[model samples]
Target chain A: MNEIPVGSSATIVGYTIHNAFTERLREFGLIEGTIIKLLRKAPWNGPIEVQYGHSQIVLRPDELTNIQVKRMM
Target chain B: MSDELPQNPSLIALVGSPNCGKSTIFNALTGLRQKIANFPGVTVEPKTGTVKLSGETSVTLIDLPGIYSATPKTPDEELTISVLKGTHANITQPNAAIFVVEGTNIEKSLFLYAQYAKLAVPTIVVVTMIDAIKGSGGVLDDIELERQLGVPVIGVVGHRGIGLDEIREYLECGDFQPPLLADNQVFTGKSTIEDQHLWAREVAREVARLPEMDSFTRRFDAVLLHPVVGPLVFLLVMLIFFQSIFTWATPLMDGIEAGFTGLRGYVEGIVPAGIVQSFLSKGMIAGVGAVVVFLPQIIILTLFISLLEDFGYLSRAAFLVDRIMGVFGLQGRSFVPLLGSFACAIPGIMSARIIPSEKDRLTTILIAPLMTCSARLPVYILLITAFVPNSLVWGFLSLQGFVLMGLYIIAALSGLVIGKIFKSTLFKGSKLPFLMELPPYRFPAAQNVFLTAFNRTKAFLTSAGTTILFLSIILWAMAEFPRFEAPQNASTADIERLQLEHSALGMIGTTIQPVFAPLGFDWKVTIGVLSSFAARETFVSVMGQMYSVDVSENNESLRVVLQRSITLPAALSIIAFYVYALQCMSTIAIIKRETGSWKYPAFAFAYTLLLAYGAALATYHVGLLLTS
Candidate 1:
């Protein structure tokens, strides 16, 4: 998806993680089936907070676009 | 042997996903005695604090930036990995790790915990936010998660200061008694542990519970987060913030002026009418006074900011702006470091720890000085008030305030554009993926608010005492050295200006004058710009010293000086110069410290200087053309 609406829930699909995002995701177990909730967005909606399982994590939007997500209930 | 505790406090490195209340738990465990340093090789920040466990065992708590892996994405992310592996250049490996996890999202929080479990350090998991999900009828089987994950798990409400002592006791003993992996079997191999993924699933299914979304939160989100209205609300809130900085700070600013005047008068009277008085009143008092007058701006700015963060609106604010930032190739997580840059760029660079991508965080740090800090407010006020007329556009809005706000806006836009260009040219990388946790909005604690305000104000004053003090003395020497013996008041303005042309500073300024003349600047303004390399706000004090004028009167004090030879447009040029300038040497130093390498900071300094010179030159010569 070119644009993910703020607060819209989506399933983790695939991602193009930079070395930093990839390394952090590896530690957090952000691999297959990691359900993400698009939490709060800002004025321009560039950086976002996501709900990965019970714990929520913050990431730049660059990391999100790569991880393909399927819109979920 | 049973009661043995190490002579030194056990060091526990707290690592987890961001916003898992790891900071809250760190504060609860260590309170205010925390030492913060920018991480080596990157602007990422790590905080070190200590908590006493038992008589013999206290914990040296290092709150690492939230990272998901032992392997890092950006230089910022590598801080935890290298340090944890005992392979970092500056630090030994941490003795243990306190892996923080969000209770509501235990399965995900445990993902990182599982990674840490294999690290071979003594690891303990503190399940935070238990109270946040308490009313949801959701409770964690902490013991079970601990069993399944092969780490000791302690559930606590860190925000409320609950479960702190049990945490201490757990840290006192570094042994892990994990849950039975298939009937009390001792774990033998990596394959066996990976095979137990199903075991973790079964435990989560049995013990963890979550409730439906709370109505108040949902309703609040409906309006605050409404796509149509969200951006508008965000703009208005920012407007109120910028306005309060000028309007609300007036009384406090006036009080500061009065205090400085009183101190100058007292020091002048007591020190007698010799070099000491001149030194105290002119050099020290004047220099420090110029810095402290901006205290009102610092206090008001940080007060509103702390409240915004406490209310949990800062993240939401970031969320709203993420889409537009993407167009510039700037990541969404840049908001924190850029926001922090308003106080000082060092901390701004350091706060980049929160950004998961090294490229984005370094990019943010590189452009941070473009943010208009309170330190630069004095120079802006000095320029705008001295030249821009005091008039109202409509019935109410003061023209001066409008110009001030415009200057801030210009600085912010410059940072973003420069960030985009920097990424494309020097730091070539695709924008890294980014995400953040949105905590349920809560009324910020009064203590947190007060502390934040206190810290900001205190730092501003210290900046005056340290870097400002040193720069002021040098500027004073430049102005007063090779003293001019004058006959009368009618000795001519041209002579004084010429006499300044001979002084150490003026000579230096004149040499640089030709270089800046195309930009419409004379030698004096050039000197002010050079002196300000130490501290941006020192531009005003340097001008005051150079002109030998009273600066305590604010607008009236500088107007007569500027009105003498400088044009309305020339003064505007200086303002433009200050707007784009990366004059703070300390900011550069901070960049060096945060990046841990000369390469990124050098790149940051070079590009920013280029942008400043180009923009300033454009504003200067173009304005001269229009006015001519």
Candidate 2:
């Protein structure tokens, strides 16, 4: 799998959700087919802030390591 | 529905939208021992106070955050929505609700009341602030209100401690289950909204018999809430608040610094000249002292803010700012969190729960750190007082103060504008409608103020302390290693500082100086700015580290070392860096957790850092040309 650099737009293919966090995400409507834009990769690589569904939000970067997105120009 | 359910005490929730005086009622029911904190990842932890009934039964009085309905669009409102349904891990069953409503605004509250009625929890309506009603020539018919809603209605005047028992009695009694809507009321398509308009009108007709409009409050709101005047009023309110933070906190700050200094001196006297004294003074005194002095500024800001919020001016301010907020696709409720940002972004981001739309809420959270919270104040004051001349701008504005004010506004506006731009360009969606219930104005509750002050102060001492101390030690090491000669005592403190400067840690600051030079910062300022990454307030203490400055409760001050040492542009640039820099590590942690992805947090960091870099660069060069 080629690693897509951050800042590239991607369509969320699927996510490996931490049960509690996933349940919490399901509550806020985060699921498949969501188009997301990766905005920044924090120095610690702890998390990423992305523009999703009309709001720019921050989430753990590993949460995205599984939720695959195909590169968009 | 389980027969094996443990006989834990029944719960009584003090429920209402923000500013409905639910907290006041909570304090009245559960006094000093109230436990206040944020719930899980969200900062909007509804305060819960345990109370023992006269019958030897115990009840946990959970004061949920203010929300407009049983179902909420934003996380904060979801606080009410979640607990009411017992879906939250913390709450297990439906019990009873003490629904608080502002007397002045009855119609808007009915919408909430009607929603709660469906939850089947025995509910009581407590109408707060009756004394002001008479002055406004409005009379509430308690009997008619009870008759109309088919529930017991009790009116309490919270400020003077009047009608508090009636509220207690109604809560204890808890035998009413009113129909969700009146016969004529039509249910809206959203099951959550049981005829919002009808319930609003029901509340208006039955509960709000007469509005006690205080002429003074009205006049004040007239100007403050005036579309044109409101923003000005908000600015003036902030200006006054900033003024008090600087002026009022000085004596207390001095006292705290002196106390720390005394502690350091006493420890030095006992230990003699070595690592003990160095560690005690530099790590303990210098590190902790820097934070303690800031305690006063934090308290004052929270105190005045709680008062203004209690008095109900905050809601009107929200209403006033809603139009402007709309321009950027933000909601008026975002104002409170933004306002909280001025004190500290941690709380500011936490408070963003009050905003209902997820998009708006996240945007508000992202931008809240931009508010020039008091944590940044020490750094701002340190720099401007050191560097910038205390001159009047345009023959009226305090140039220094206005610059401070401009930095704050810039942070807030940039947050909104960026959020808007993100919404328009990067994240595509129309702005959500700004819907809120304006709580009727009342006297700010005194007990609530103390509780709030205590909570924030405790957070500062504990949560804030642990984070800063850990970061300080790391940064100190960044300046401490690669041991160099201890310069002979001009003073012991001087020797310790020379040790710090020549140490490995100090070299790190020098290394970072070139990167920050565009912002008019020297290596020392660069180091403080970097150390401040742990928390913005640490900038002041890092400066203390640089200067070997010490202080205590009796004889101490930040102005002493800062006065002659710093130039104006350096101070301005420092303030500018803080103004734009997303230096709070905690905020990034929170954002990561809240959004459930690392992607957005990373985005927040990159963009904020970029913004800070560009702005600080501009401020440095522009300031140099102007000053020279």
Best by TM-score: 1
Overall local distance difference test of candidate 2? 0.64
Find the 10 residues in a row with the least total lDDT in model 1 chain B: B190-199
Model 2 spans > 4 angstroms off: A1-73, B1-9, B55-57, B101-108, B130-153, B160-163, B166-238, B319-431, B481-498, B501-504, B507-579, B582-606, B614-628
lDDT of 2 by residue, B584-603 (tens): 76666556544545676678
lDDT of 1 at B564: 83
Write candidate 1's Cα lDDT for B105-174 as tens digits.
6655544554455666666678887887786677677676765666677888876778888888777766
Q: Which ten residues in a row have the lowest lDDT in candidate 2 chain B?
A: B430-439
Candidate 2 scores an fnat of 0.00
TM-score per candidate:
0.80, 0.67
Indicate which candidate wins on lDDT.
1
